[model samples]
Target chain A: MDRIQQIYNDEKLLKKLQEDQNLTIEDVLENEMVINMGPQHPATHGVLRLVLRLDGETVVGIVPELGYLHRGYEKMAENMSHIEFIPHTDRLDYTGTMCNNVGYVLAVEKLAGIEAPKRAQYIRMIVSELSRIAAHMVAIGTFAMDVGAVTMVMWTFREREKVNSIFDRIAGARFTTSYTRIGGVASDIDDQAFAEIKQFLAELEPALVEMDKLLLSNRIFIQRLEGIGILPKEDAIALGVTGPNLRASGVEYDVRRAKPYLFYNEIDFKIPTFSQGDCLARYFQRGDEVRESIKILYQCLDKIPQGEVIANNPKKVLSHKTEIYSKMEELIHDFMIINFGINPPIGDTYLSVENPKGELGFYIVSNGSGQPWKLKIHSPSFCNLQAVSQLCKGAMVSDVVAIIGSLDPVMGEADK
Target chain B: MNTKELIVEKIKEKFGESVEEVSDFRDDLCITIKKDQIVNLGKYLKEDPDLQFIMCKDVTAIDWATRKKRFTTVYHIYSFKLNYALRLKSNIDDNPPTIETVSFVWQSANWYERETWDMYGIKFINHPDLRRMYMPEGFEYHPLRKDFPVLGIPGSLPLPFKAE
Candidate 1:
C-alpha cells in the first residue's frame, strides 16, 4: 500500500504517464474505459479485433488490429511457380475465388503476352458473375443476420447453394474452384452445365425480390441502417475505397466500365450509383449489383462464341489431357510445363477485375523466371477496412456492426 | 499526343532532372523519379487539371536484392476524370530503406505505406502511423525480403498441418 502510494505520488512517474498517454491527472481519474471488441466476435464477421475506447456506450476512438490470418501469400508466391499460386489466390478471397483466380490469370497472361480465346473470355465472365452473385448473397445474408434479421441468411444461402451447384457442375470443386488457367480455363463448360446456369438465372430474380421484401422493406432495418456510417464522395476516393462502397458514394468507377477486361467491353451493364453513401446505400448498391450481374450472365450466355477455350500457343499454355496422354511429344510438353512452369517475359503487369467486393488487383513482377520476382495483391477489403476509424467517429457502438457488414470484408484477403 | 504521351511530356516539363527514367509497358506509363520528389509529384498528379490522378490505387515496394538501390517503391495512381493510369517508382538505398509518405496526397496511402513497411522493412518518412501492419509489432525480420527462406526460418515450430 505504501509502495503503491509512493509510485502514484512520484513526480517523474506522473510526468511519464502524462507524456505517454497525453492525459491530464483529471482525465486519468475520469471513467474512460478501453475495451476490446473481438478477435473472435461474430459481429466482426471474421478474425478482426477492434480496440474501442468508450465513454458511456459512445465510441471515442477505434484501433483496428489485423493479420490474424496472414499466411505470407506474397512471400509464398515468390517461391512457387505461376501456376502453383492460382490455388493460393482462391484462399485469399475464399468466397469469391473465381474473381481472384481470373484477376491472377489475367495479370499472368498480360505478363506473358497471351490472351484467352473469345469463348474462354465469355466463360470467364459468366463464372465471375456467378461468383459475384454467390459472394453478394453471403454479404447481404450475413449483413442482415448481423442486424438481427435471422431469416435473411437462410433465404440468401438457399440461392447461394443453387449457384454453388452450378459451380460444382462446371468446375470439380464447389468452393475454391481454381477453374481458370493462365491462358484459358481448365475445361470448357458442357451443355448440361450451361442448362444448370440458365435454370439458376431463371430462379434468381424471384429470390432477389424475396430478399428485398424481407430486409429492404423492414422498417426497423432501414431505421438502423439509413443515414448511418456516411462516407462522403471525396473521402471515399481519397481513402481508395472501391466497388459498391465507392459506387454508393456516387463514384462511377467500376473497373468493368472504367477499364474493360475479359469481354466486359462487348457485354452491356449498368454501374449502380447512390449519392447517400450510408449503410443503407451500400446495402442497396449490392442488391442492384446482383441484378446487373444477372444481366451480364444472360448476355454472356447469348453472345458466347463457339470456339477454342484455351490459347493455341503450345509453348505458353499446357495442352489438353487427351493430347498429353496419347502423343509422346505432347507428354513431354506437359512434363516440361509442370516441371519448369510457364515463364513470362521479364516485366511487370497490373490487372484488376470488378470483384464482388471491389477492384481486386494483382501486380506481378516477373524476372524472366517461372516464379514471380514479386507479387502484390491490392485487396479491396484491406483498403475498405482502413475507413472504419474515419466512419465510426462519434457514432453509437451498435453502428459499428452495420458499418463493418456494409463494408463486407473478408479477413483472409485483408490479412494477406 | 495520346494520354500516356501527354502525361510523360507534362511530367518531363514539370521536373526535368528529377524524372529518372520513363517507360511504357503494356500501355501503362511508368515513371521512375527521384525519391525526394515523390510527394511533390503526388500533389501535382492529384491537383493537375488535365491529369487528375485523384485515386492512389496501390502503394507497394519490390526488393531488388542485387541492386545498389535495393528497394523500389511503386505507386499506382488512377485518374477517373482523365481516364488514365500512372505508375510512379522511386528507388531507396538506406539500410532500412526510407521514402516520403504520400498519405497526405491520398488518405489511402496510410495503410499501403504501413503494409510496405511491414513486409519489406521500408520506412516511410512523415507517415503518421509508421508501424507494422500485417505483421505483429517487434517482429525481427521482414518476411518478404529476398533473403528470407521460403520454408521459413529454421528452429521455428513446424506447421501443424501436413500437406496431403
Candidate 2:
C-alpha cells in the first residue's frame, strides 16, 4: 500500500497527470467550437462548406453544407431534348467529362433502344479510360497538394495536359469535351490521336512510379495518412459510398464488374481494393486504378475493330454535316433531329457507368416526348460525401483535409 | 427462372396482395408495391438470407401531377452477394404526399429522402434530418413539380430590367 502510494505520488507521474488534466480543463473551457471550413477554401477542391464542431483538436460533429455549385441540372434536363442534354452532362464531372458524356448517352440510348456500333463502344472505352487516368491524376495531385506535397500536382498536371491534348484532337474541346452523341461518340479517334494516347500511356507509367516513391513511400506522408479516417466496410456500403472510397473500404463492387455495360466484360482489368479503409488505402486505390485504366487503354487500342462509329438510324440519329449539306434527304434528317429532337418511347430507365469518381447514373423518364419527363442523376460524389460526417467523427481537425482529399469529390458532380 | 423472376416470385409469395404490379423491361426488374409496405419490404429484403440487398443505390421521387397518384417514389436496391438490382416503386397521392422513411433500413436513404422531400415536396416520415438539401432554407416551393414553371417560380427571379 505504501509502495502504491509512493508510485502515485512520484514527481514525474504527478507532472504527467497535471499536464493531462490541464488539457481536459482547456477542452472543457473551450467547449465545442463551431468552425466553418469553406464554401471557398483550397483544401475543399470546390465550394464545399463543412461546419465542423470541434472539441479542441478533435472533430466532435460535422454538418456538410453543399449545393453551392447547384446549376439545376436535373430540372434543366426536363426542358432540353435528348441530344441537347449531352453537353450539360459534361459539367456534371468536368474532370471526367468523357465518362459523364458516355453515362448520359448510354441512358438516352437505353431509353431509345439504340445501340452504338462495336467500334464506337471500343473507342468510347478508350477515351473513357483516358479520362479516368486524367481525373485520377488530378485527384492524386490535389490530394498530395492538400497534404503539403505541392510538387506532385505539377507532375500529375503534366501527364493530364498530355491527355487533354489527345482529347482535343479527337473531341474538339479539352476539358468540357461533349464528345459523346446519343447513338455514338461525336468523332472517331484518328491515327495521330491514337499514337499520342499511346505515347501518354508510355510516359504515365514512369511518372506514376516516381509519384509512388515521392508520396506513397515517404515516411511523413504515410504517418499523416496511415489508419487516419478509417471508414468501416459496413458503414461505407450503408452510406452508398462507391469508387475508390468504397473500394478502399474493401468492397469489390465496381459497376463495370457488377453490371458490365459497354465492352467492360471484354476488357481484362482488375478492381483494386484495400482492407485498411483509411486515407492511405484510398490513395493507393486511385494509384492502382490508374494502372488498371492503363491496362484497359492498351486492350482497347489493340482490339478496336475498324467500322462505322455511329449507329445508322436515319429516323432517330442525325447525319454528318457534310452529308447533310450534299443531300436534301440528309439535310432534312439533320434539321428534324436537331429541331424536333429524338423522341424515345414512354418509359423509365436507369443506366450507370463507372466514372473515375464512382458510379455516375442517369435515370430518365420519358413521356413519349422529345424531352425527358424527369431526369435524376445519381452522382457518386454526392452519395460518397454523405459518409463524410461518419468518417470525420473522432478524427483530428487536421485530418479533415486529408479525409476530404482522399474522398476525391468534385462539387460540380455533387451539386448537380 | 432467372434472377428477376425469382425476385418477383419471392416478393409476391411473401407480401401476397401487397405487391401491386411487376414488370421486366430490358431485363431490369421493376416492382411496384403498396406505399405503406415499403419500410417492411425494405427490412425483409435486407435481412432475408435469400435476398440480401445490402445497398440502397438511389432513392428518387417522380412527380406525375396529372395522375391520380401524383408521385412515384423509386428505390433502387442492389445485392452484392447475388449481383442483382431491383427497382421498387411506391405511388403517393398528391394531397400531402408522404411515405414511410426507409432510412432506418439503409443509412444512405437519409440524404436521398431529404433530397426527394426538397425537390418533390414528398414528406418522409421519421427521417432524422428531413430538410432542404439543394435549395436553401426558407425556400418554400418544390421546383421539380410539373406545376412549377420551367424557368422557375413566375416573378421569383430577380430581373435586371423590369417588364414594361
Poorest stretch of ten by lDDT in candidate 2 chain A: A20-29
| lDDT tens digits by residue: candidate 1, A256-334 | 9888999889888998899999999999999999999999999999999899999877778999989989989888878
lDDT of 1 at A144: 92
Model 1 stretches with alpha carbons more than 4 Å out: A1-30, B154-164
Supply the TM-score for candidate 1: 0.94
Global local distance difference test of model 2: 0.91
Tell me the lDDT of candidate 1: 0.91
Question: In model 2, how large is the Cα lDDT of residue B40?
Answer: 91
RMSD in angstroms, all models?
4.9, 8.1
True contacts kept of 2: 0.67
| List of clashing residue pairs for candidate 2 | none
lDDT of 2 by residue, A187-287 (tens): 88889998998898999899899999898667778888999999999999999998889999999989998999999999898989999999999999999
* Residue A201 lDDT (model 1): 93
lDDT of 2 at A319: 74
Best DockQ goes to which candidate?
A: 1
